[model samples]
Target: MRNHSGHDQADHEGHGGAQPGGLSVSEHGYTLEFDSTILTAGVQPVSFRVIGPDGQAVTEFLSEHDRELHFIAVRRDTAGFQHVHPVMDEKGTWSVELALEPGDWRFFTDIHPVGHDGTMTLGIDVAVAGPYDPRPLPEATGIAHIGEYTVALDGELLPGEPSELTLTVSRNGRPVADLQPYLAAYGHLVALRVGDLGYLHVHPEGEPGDGATAPGPGIAFMAVAPTAGTYRLYLDFQHNDVVRTAEFTVRTATAAPKHAERHHGHHAHH
Candidate 1:
């Protein structure tokens, strides 16, 4: 499904899914392992493990961004959004505990081995039980690059029109330097409608599709907002042991005009 912007609250009243020992989403053979369940608006604990296309645990080999899996929870109608890190039980199993309202929701983990590009992934999904009343929201901006490795965005419907965005990167009051690669890609950016937090993991094309990742000198991506409204943007990059993130709000306008959270909290700098 092309989930580009804000998710409609009414569209998701009830939802659920089940899979154990990992379920396969792509025919190429990648599998997701997790013990999952559907719950009413309450506390939910879940675990996600990455098993390769060959069915082997490949966590240690993943890049700084890949070695550890992230668990983001958003309400189906797109209300509550939380960025969370799962504890790796050993080298393969990772777990997290969260409390959320019901509706059709998504949990995404985009990580890859240092050199395994195409193997990047999103591994979990669950349905929760609730009274199904979503909160109201203002239109959000799609993502845009506010200069200096900084990015922004806003999302709103321009039905039948295309949604295009430009992102620029700079650092320390300069155009940014070094640009080392992390997770086999030149810097990765993922977008999701804030309300539903659906995943729109995207990258600039022409990038090698091999297991090789891309480093950067400033990167930009173009995409179509499946629908439009308010969407949240997340960017991840590694300079060495550290993975830095710049997040902003952006919008998809039918006409001209536009522009857009991470790392305010005590995020351990790698």
Candidate 2:
């Protein structure tokens, strides 16, 4: 068997990787960029950065809280799953020694400030080649705000069917398109298959919402749950002078397509 370092040694510590009070990718748009191939086991490492709106750095380390950068990697088919912590070598260059199989994979980072409500984020798709994208957004139907940063969602879910999760993001009760580069990407979206806490990393196709236009009606990346489960959804976005956290619980569609089976830990019910 080959040894891979999807997550670091520190990641598998005290609280089963997912901690109670720490950084857990609360927001969306934590940028993930690097050569998928790790040239050296010890030297040739991965590189990337995450910036905050206040012109500060949103680090993976949340000592005042808990874990540093909480990263979740799941293949499009949900077959390959990695819950690893990339060591921040530089400003935003988080490095890890995980050899990934040739396939389309998505990376979502949960970032937060210790002792504060500032949770910044981003998501990126890793292909051997090509620019990133989200062609069309999932259509948002019964939208509600359960008091996070923006809107809360009320939708349907099914097993073995492709389902779209339409999301609307805004601040101060208005569309927040012109959302600045939070973390390193535009916006961030994370979807967990309800009960078992399966992970889905969803990214915005286009730039964030402009103050002129509505922030979203931004569709989240699509996914299908292996088994019917109650999913919890969390989104992180930043604009103006504040960072917003929008959260909700959703059930996968009954007609949801069939994807690979991936397992995850319990939700950190903050």
Candidate 3:
């Protein structure tokens, strides 16, 4: 596993010393320029573009995860998460329709420019004008139910450490073994820290055709929490040719002290 700190440091430097992903609208020399930042509450079309350093909308991009770009939309309170791909025009403007409610929304674009070193996630906030009533975040849990499917999470997140997370999918108490490949994998996981919505786009441990990886009920991923905090996880899996997302609220576990023997000795003496 790659060290979180080291990876973050490299990202910081590579993105012209900007803050982490999903925290800024502009990074390095690219900017997320939206056509409008205010919209009506409901399903509406939104348009935006990634303006490159040359002051033009970027038209050339390298595909990542079977697409040139990935778009994510979530409310400010970490509710109403939607992962959708936008259709980019020849002029570099991308458009997509989103089912937005009466609240503040954050839109993130995960993209890799042709000459960029790595992928970059850029975020912008939009306001849907209406009577906004923010809902409290759901309590931390290991299980989430989506329609007829139930996803059970079996793993613990340790602060600043790479942890293995396995999510098993079942429908009506039966394991789903004939899972279809989505984005070249059995699943795609996106982790966002609660307060700041720090974005982490994580892929599954193994590919779909790999001999060791099973297509069945369990999808594994290695995720690193930047700190000890509450985070919201979204898992997009495909079955029966339809993509569905399972959401979970997870809190990082604090690591134990390393000098336990010395501390016990002091207490015994006392």
- TM-score, one value per model: 0.49, 0.39, 0.88
Say which candidate scores most in lDDT: 3
Q: Residue by residue across 33-80, what tens digits does model 1's lDDT show?
A: 666656566776777666777777656644333344545666555456
Models ranked on lDDT: 3, 1, 2
Q: State the lDDT of candidate 3 residue by residue for 73-190, as single tens digits.
A: 9999988899999999999999999999988889999888988877788999999899999999999999999899999999887665557799999999999988999987899888
Better of 2 and 3 by TM-score: 3
lDDT per residue, candidate 2, 1-270, as tens digits? 000112321232111123211123323333334545222222234555665445445554463123576666544444344545677755656766455555565565655544434433345666533333422322334454635445645345555443555566654576655665654334455555532344544454433333433344454444343456565455666566555556555655554233322211223332
Report lDDT (CA) for all predictions: 0.50, 0.46, 0.82
TM-score of 3: 0.88
lDDT of 1 at 186: 55
lDDT of residue 134 for candidate 2: 25
Candidate 1 Cα deviation (angstroms), residue 189 = 6.8
Instruction: Point out where model 2 deviates above 4 Å.
Output: 1-149, 152-155, 207-219, 256-270
- Model 1: residues with Cα > 4 Å off, grouped in runs: 1-24, 65-67, 141-190, 193-198, 201-251, 255-270
